[model samples]
Target: MPNSNPAHTSKYEESGVSQTGAETALGHLLKHVLPTRQFNTQFPVKADIGYFANVIDLGNGQGVALCTDGVGTKMRVAELLNQYDTIGIDCVAMNVNDLICIGARPISMVDYIACSHIEAHVFDQLGQGLAEGARQAGISISGGEISQIGEIITGIDLIGAALGHIHLDRINTGQHIQPGNLILGLAASGVHSNGLTLARRVLLGETPEMQQERVHQYESALDRTLGAELLEPTRIYVQPVLEMFEAGIDLKALVHITGGGLLNLLRVQTQNIRFVIDPVPDVPPVFSLIQQRGDITDAEMYEVFNMGVGFCIVVEHANDAEAVQKICKQHSISCHGIGYVETTDAGHNEVVVPSKNLIGSGSRFSAA
Candidate 1:
């Protein structure tokens, strides 16, 4: 969290999600599940535990990264609007963005759609979004599954797995993210695929006043129903971040700002350093709209939403910061020089944003 926006008394109480319980379950799962995946004698497991993507050796000094993620409660927004096209893009973005965090170039993806029953137009619309997302990421839609489990579930849940390859020498596991490294922030499209449980709880009331509020369009950054803004697809960083690599900008760390907002920065670093982020990017109108409706504090907003910076990069050399800015401009990505890595004065692996009164030393999210 960037600032201590007085923890919402109901942050965990009324919100329908339990990040802490999920992490505890994951910890238990890792203990039993990880011990069984033995290293490949030929393509040995190079990186699996404690990182963004799991890397198993692919022989001849090459490795493969595989990551899978699903469109979470954002799908509820799609359902609320009776729109089904763009949620597939959220599925791809959630998966491929995590794949790139380990410096792998995404090559292909496979989608999974589970619904009570598939409507013909809904299927076609979902496929349209998937195809467009694949084009944006420069990856193939290799294969997928669509199942109608009548009693097993409700509406369609879109999920996907992305695969990428990298030379072992090119892997960036944040092992070298040392003190004094520059942190570069990338702009988000809008609340990219997380925290919808709280959003829906606060925004989806059935009262006449709530209905009026949902349809009320804003004058600032957004011009649609609050529900429409919630349905915006997650942004995919594969192409531009790949361009950064092709441009020879050696990034030491990459953080995908999903779920836990600024605290996602901890995922790309060792436990010995602290991140001091100054002056977060301006919150997009959609997010501000949610804050106003929910009566959410700045700290809580940063805790749940991306707060505009969708992705982050760390570079050891200060001079590389300008090169990064120039290249990102060529791609038209809004890049901000937000913060830097430095030795921890209090604890290990913490992110402190004084302006926001947030200290992200520990994240409530777990990508494991």
Candidate 2:
């Protein structure tokens, strides 16, 4: 049977090390391996901005919008590849996708662009990509800010806020998540704009010849260059999800798997629920290559990257699941039954990996 323990033997294991020492090293690694914090600390909740924004009753419905995310080191990749068009799409996808997590239908977005010196072509590409992304998400680019600080800025920084509206009665805030609720995964569009720091460290660290060779290998394997593959526009699911809700399907919870990966599911507020992801979707070729090349552990990969599945919706165990799946299929998107929820300690939380091994397994009852 696969080892239930989170610790796994690595290629670097030495024969002379004592079991206790090995266990200590493994434990230390695990401690830093997973994201300890609940969410991204960089994106703080802004209460002051809401003072002047237009208000919609959304009648009893929660305005489940998220002002989360930044372009991160992906900008460097775009700079290196001399491609600025797609990064704007990523900026929009990063925030709008989070808005949909709580069953919010994205209505409008505003971007923040910071640059030391803005070139005309760069601005044009960014604008084009943002327009394309907004069109795909069925939202409007209401307004945005472009700050020019010759000293404070470097290349370019792109971030945005997405506004979404959901009926209070229709929001999937995980309140309905029960022990038997099914976890459905929506496949990602290649990396969906996270974990580039590690990818650059691992894949781009080789010699020039090695870099070219690696890129070629990735293209052959994944049918796209490593740089292009990593920059694939983020999948926008706002319309599909909103349509599902409009059709009267009861989605229990929705999760946008970003920097925290599958662990993001923990952000949902439902009592006594534990998630068991027994059959995760296959990891895309790019991720497999990175994992094999860097010798990254499963826990580390999930913590740092979205793997293959970008978005997930927790739904009831009724025939409506088929209807939801059909809608996703009509959009040419793939879905999978990743796992189910179970009643555990009142506030205790657990994420059981496929090997029956618990990684971010811990008790949240005290905090809850």
Candidate 3:
């Protein structure tokens, strides 16, 4: 089991991102934002305020799932490496992956790009990446806006809102997730889009010159330059997941393990259950490099980065788990039954990664 540190500032906070701060700030924001849900009764909101995605009842027994996300400090890597092509894929993956959690089949997206200055090559590369991502997700880029707000914007900002379709009755609100269900983890391509701030601060360096020196160096374990590894595009799980939906697999819950790591599993609507992840997959090489370089704790690493799993699916029966694995394998995604959901004596929900001796609740993970 991993050792626990005493209460103090986490290394991630030192990197300039605060998980607790964000939660508090978000609460204040939601206080103002959630009331707007009553503004339009014709298309009532289907999901609650903070599921992976929100669906709007469109009448006629249909719902449209929608979500918006952007590439975070991972964009800094693109700016540093002069690579602007792949992050569009990251932007797309971030939004669409969330939509799938609600069992929506993505159909279209609109993008918004804000940059300090208009650079022709950068825009061209971004378009190429967006086109490719849309192709992979089987969605169309309906429209977009590009703005040159030099005073307000820095290098660049890429964000998109994705829309997907689902039958009102078919929305997977995770209400069906039960104690006997299994948790299946899907492989991540690399770091994905989360935790890059800490990753950069640790692996590259805090100073610009130091980061420049390190980003270009070849890493033997990665077999590529450090910047390239960091810039790797996020994997889009739409096809395989949609196939599972089409196969009549009882997907009780779908989780996109993003900024909160394994703790994202708690977003499911189920109650009085804890997810216990044992026999977790091996940590990928890039994450290992970050941990060793940063001297980060196991609890912190699992709470920040994906470690290895990018996505998780909850299914009621063992046979359903096997069917999910088969579908993912056919799609070339490595899937494993890493854990099981169990009834918890504690009233609140939790995520327990036993190998690391860590337990997570609400917004953060602590050493057990």
Candidate 4:
């Protein structure tokens, strides 16, 4: 259990991330941007603004799923460690994982790199990482752009847009998730490119010099340098998920648990239901270390980080849940039945974790 001391300021906000603030800004931005669907009536958007990915109907019973994501502050870890290789994989994982939520087969991606300087060796390493990520996702790096703006970008920024193919008839909008459906959790590999701002502040110290010194220091708890642990690339779930699709498993909702933790479960298309996570997967050591060191509350930890589970799959039948676990097993990814859904008339969705005494509404979680 994490510390529930209210005396502690919101750890994530103290680390300079305001989830509520971001949501408020996004709400305002979407009100103006979401209306752009009228701009192209021929290929209108299929998914709403807040879904993992947006699908655009392309006619002929086909649709294209599109999403964009970046490595976020995880890139700073790479910069401090001077290891650019795995960060590109994080970039690809972040984008393609979202694309798969809509039951889309990721086909291709285009990367955008903005850097203060164009060093050949760094670019080569980033390219290698991208290639490895593409291979893992079974997608192509069809194109990219590099901007050398020394004044604006001190180190580098890596972002990408992924486009995937989905049969218009088979798009998963979570409309099928219902009462009695089980939630399956896939294990995460370390932090997986989120909450780094808070993580760094907690584990490695706040200042750059302190972080630089601590990054190379080994702790018995992790049995590795902090930098190495933090640098673990985001796991690419493309193969296992696509295999599950091919195996005829009906995945009602596919969730990439990035940044928002379990609260992300409420982002599905289903409404007026409550997700009850009774038995969360074992808390990974790294996350525990962060919580202990930061004196962060359990609610704050789950709100900002993946904690242990990185991805979630919702299935209606017990056999389908078993199949999901088996598929994940074959891929060497750990899976568990963490919770179930129940129909509710509360007029809004909620995520309840009984073990933690936490219930989530909107973007944040609080003690029950």
Candidate 5:
């Protein structure tokens, strides 16, 4: 028989931490940790696909790039709300947003949808959302696949892959991220499609009617239910970022803050560098309500939610920072100089939280 007391479990004996605490720490590690890649390995296939985009050297200054990602467990909230339309847009935005992070111009996209059963209405709404997303990203949906796997899929799963083009020398892979660089933040379009699993588990515990009532209290103009707010399509950054690159700005690195929240920025830099963010904007009301209702820790809230800023660019000191702001304004997108890069000790990459109680507790990136 299994031990009823969790303290007797092997996990507790080995780690000396409580079972509940160990479980939480393990979950956090799995979500936040990134594995290191070795450079001395011989390979039959040679391609680096770690950054926002992967570029292949085909000689002659021409190259093909690709980026792929999914909307993640945000689909679960959409399922609970019976809203599947806008998720397709989230799928596209997640990939294209990353593509632009490496200065790639998104040219085409392909979607993969797996479902438990075939429902024409579901596909219709999903298709409309996907088409609209592709249009917004300035990319064509050449083709995609829909798998009806009843036994494997409990709800619909939407994922996408994007193909793009970039010049050989134009990729922003953080190779030029020097000390004293400026970090520019691009505002998110509400939630922007991440951390929904935790959000739903913690925030949306009420029934559909209860959720409607709660959401209406926050936003008087919101006629749709709470699920609708959760399903807001992710903002596509392809056009604006690409425009910045074409304008001859010396961009050093770009970070797309997705599944891992602000921590995603650490993926682009390795040396002892810190981001000093000042005047962190007020989080969305929905997020505020979630934090208040759940009484969630401030660290957990920033770790799991975008909390306003979504995408960021590390620009060289010599770059035209004003051009970035002007272009973003011309496109009607909000842009701000949120922070600056600072040198640190070896093997330390940190994000300085502006708030003392919340994420401002000095969170360090775990070993990748």
Candidate 6:
């Protein structure tokens, strides 16, 4: 368990971004109106408005899943350190991870890079990381666009959109998730590309010491420079999840713990099921250091960053969890049995963090 909360401040809110505000802003945007048919096929599009990725049915038990995501504020850390290699991996991981949440096997990806000016060597280095990521994810970089939008952008912004295939019958829609399902957690590779905005504000905020310091000057509890620790690329979980799928294991739901932190778990859940997460396991040392340095409350930390758990798997039974853990270990990623699912009030979707008064509502955190 983590240390008890004392007086703590919210880093994300102070940084001029609000989770609630982002959600509200999205509400007014034009709804995605899908045409009834494309090419006169009998199969229609599966309206995947809330899940991790949108599934487009192509009939005959075949479907395509597509998702797009960026590396978020993690780019700032990379810029500060002058390292551009692993950020590309973060970009691919963000998209492929989301695609697999709906049981899609990522087939290929295309990247979009926008910047005022990018060095030739920098692009080459980024390509190296992207290739490595595609290999790890078993995908290909088919095509992309790189635009030099002078003056309009000051920093490099990289985004990737990935497409995958899945059998609709094999999709883990969470509609079948019921009481007594085991919740399995896959350990993160450090913070894994989210919440760097709050982290940067906490560590390098307007201090003379920071101005004089280099990324290597700060040593992390994980026995690495803070820059290297923060630069650790996001882990790719596609292989293991797909392996389980191949082995005939039924994945009830997949949560690629990202921007909303543990709250990402709620995207698949409905009002009838309450996901009761256990008190987090011994958090990674990197996260502990962040919490202490930022004076961030446990609830806020869990809400903003992954707090050490990168991916979550909801299985039909405890035996299924053990099997999944075994598969994760074989793939060389750390794994843990984190929590379970249970019955809840109708249309009352909630994720209860055991032993804490923190529960995730639809759009924000609320007192349990």
Instruction: Report every candidate's CA lDDT.
Output: 0.79, 0.71, 0.91, 0.92, 0.70, 0.81
RMSD to the true structure for each prediction, in A, is 3.5, 8.5, 1.3, 1.2, 7.3, 2.8
Better candidate by TM-score, 1 or 2: 1
- Model 4 Cα lDDT, one tens digit per residue, 1-368: 56786566788888899887998999899899988889999998998878889899999999999999999999899889988988989999999999999899999999999989888889999999999999999999999999999988699999999999999988997889989999999999989988999999999999999999999989789999999999999999999999998998988999999989988888899889999997878998899999898888988888889988999999999999999999899999999999999988778999998988898888788888
Model 6: number of backbone collisions: 1
> Over the stretch 177-254, how does candidate 2's per-residue lDDT look in tens digits?
888888899899888887776776566653545544554344577776787876778888877887887897878887
- Which portions of model 2 show Cα errors greater than 4 Å? 1-66, 206-218, 361-368
Q: Please, what are the lDDT tens digits per residue for candidate 3 over residues 1-368? A: 22256475688999999888999999999999999988999999988877899899999999899999999899899888888888899989999999999999999999999889888999999998898899989999999998889899788989999999999998886889888889999999999999999999988999999998898989999999999999999999999999998899989999999998999999888789999998888889999888888878888898899999999999989999999999999999999999999999888999998887788898788877
Q: What is the lDDT of candidate 1?
A: 0.79
Tell how far residue 186 is off in model 2, in angstroms. 0.7
Q: Could you give me the TM-score of model 2 versus the true structure?
A: 0.79
lDDT of 2 at 56: 32
User: In model 2, which residue pairs have backbone atoms overlapping below 3 Å?
Assistant: 60-168, 61-167, 61-168
Clashing residue pairs in candidate 3 (N, C-alpha, C atoms within 3 angstroms): none
Q: How much does candidate 3 score in TM-score?
A: 0.98
- As for lDDT, the candidate ahead, 1 or 2, is 1
Q: How does candidate 2 score on lDDT?
A: 0.71
TM-scores for all predictions: 0.91, 0.79, 0.98, 0.98, 0.81, 0.92
Tens digit per residue, CA lDDT, model 1, 134-214: 888989999999888979888878889889989888888788888888899988888889887777666666443564456
Better of 2 and 6 by lDDT: 6
* Winner of 1 and 5 under lDDT: 1
What are the clashing pairs of model 6? 271-348
Per residue, candidate 6 scores C-alpha lDDT tens digits across 1-368 of 44444434356888766877788766655243334346556666674467888888898889999889888877877777778888889999999999999889999999999888979888997898899999999999999999999778877889999999988887766777878888889988878988877776665564435722645556636787777887899999999989998888878889999987888888884457888888566688877777787766777788888888899998987778888989999999888888888887756777888666787767555556
